[model samples]
Target: MTSAKRVAIMVTCMVDQVMPEVGVAAVRLLRRAGYTVEFPAEQTCCGQPFFNSGFRAQAADLAKRSLDIFEPYDAVVLPGGSCAAMIRKEYPHLLERWPGGVARAEALAARTYELSEFLVHVAGWQPAPAAGAPRVTYHDSCHMNRLLGLGAESRALLSAAGCAIVEMHESDRCCGFGGVFSIRIPEVSNAMTQEKVRRADATGAEVLVSADPGCLMQMRGFAHQTGMRLAHLAVLLEELTR
Candidate 1:
């Protein structure tokens, strides 16, 4: 709301290496909405990688590093719901498993926010008008919806941006790209994702919208395999302002 309100962009590992533009776009949107945005390059992975990998010790260390790097900001925001859910929901549990984990994670998670949740609920963003638009559907990220309880904020934002938000049958279904789960069981993940892709196709939507790149990657692979087109929410939002 003012110059005093500082926002830290938590550019997750995937967004940092693969889709830096999504991070850039997040900064743009927040800055336009009147917040002073800053990127703390000292920040690295959010520790979920190791936690989900069954390496709790490494995860604790990584969590400590992340907490130190991002703790100073007034509010920390991430583009992906899974990463954000890690901060808001999973980090505390992971940290508390050993010594000095709960207090540390609580301190950090208190200030964390998902971009869409922050934009719509905290910033009170008004929807942009919708013209005749392509049929679009959103695949709710498991962590975001089930873990963070982030309901409709992403969809509301898209709808406001004038995109046709179609319900892809089981919109709340998991896409099977559960971090290490996919690597551990590729066939299972593929089957789960194929079902998701087919449901999206059933909506007759030209594009599939999702908040996380992991889901996007798996689903995109299936889409490509089936010759279907899918897009992430970051890319779709980027198109809205253009």
Candidate 2:
């Protein structure tokens, strides 16, 4: 019955281009939950970058195209919270001036869910226990946590999957991966990242997990210097469950 629900995977540009493995893990997890996962080849950016850059016209155009690509699916799932939030939270606002745009964006928003949210809430998924539990800390990505209101879902799922949760200092603080914000203000961003890496390292966690690919990449930049292992939540979950 779950397979009857066709979900389109919106592989965010970062995951598609830099971290395809996270997308692979997402597919694996969705398949294990009995859903028919799909990739809409015509899909492109959700327009967050443009929107964040104050290019409303360009962002709205991309959002409209995204609506067309994902509108036919039963649900749209993406690994990054930032992009998911862009669609679920910002799409309607961005499309407000277009004809029937509000309605279309709202409809798409209603069916879109972040992967952890979809898995935990819609699919009623629970991971099988791993043979050896790893001590881990969770990073609450800004958009995913504040915009999408998803704080405990990842922790809850990880706990159920048999990970020993280590409390990272200020786990909810921003990791400075505000898409282009990092590029715009590298000094400030690097400082914040160093602080975040310090906190993650202080936890002495065997691995640090984040649901957002952006967050994973940002933290991974300092992992070598910090001696902290980093993993996307999908990858961590897939491994634990397998």
Instruction: Score every model by TM-score.
Output: 0.92, 0.97
Model 1 worst lDDT run, 10 consecutive residues: 125-134
- Clashes per candidate (backbone, < 3 Å): 2, 0
Best by TM-score: 2
The CA root-mean-square deviation of candidate 1, after full C-alpha superposition on the true structure, stands at: 2.0
Which residue pairs collide in model 1, if any?
Answer: 95-101, 128-160
Q: Model 2 off-target regions past 4 Å? A: 1-3
Cα lDDT, all candidates: 0.81, 0.90
Task: Output the lDDT of residue 174, model 1.
Answer: 96
lDDT of 1 by residue, 1-242 (tens): 32486799998998888778778878877776668899998977988878898898888788778888987887898888988888878778877766777887897788788888888866676546557656788899899899888858888878878878789888999998998999899999989998988888888777888888778877877786554467667666766755
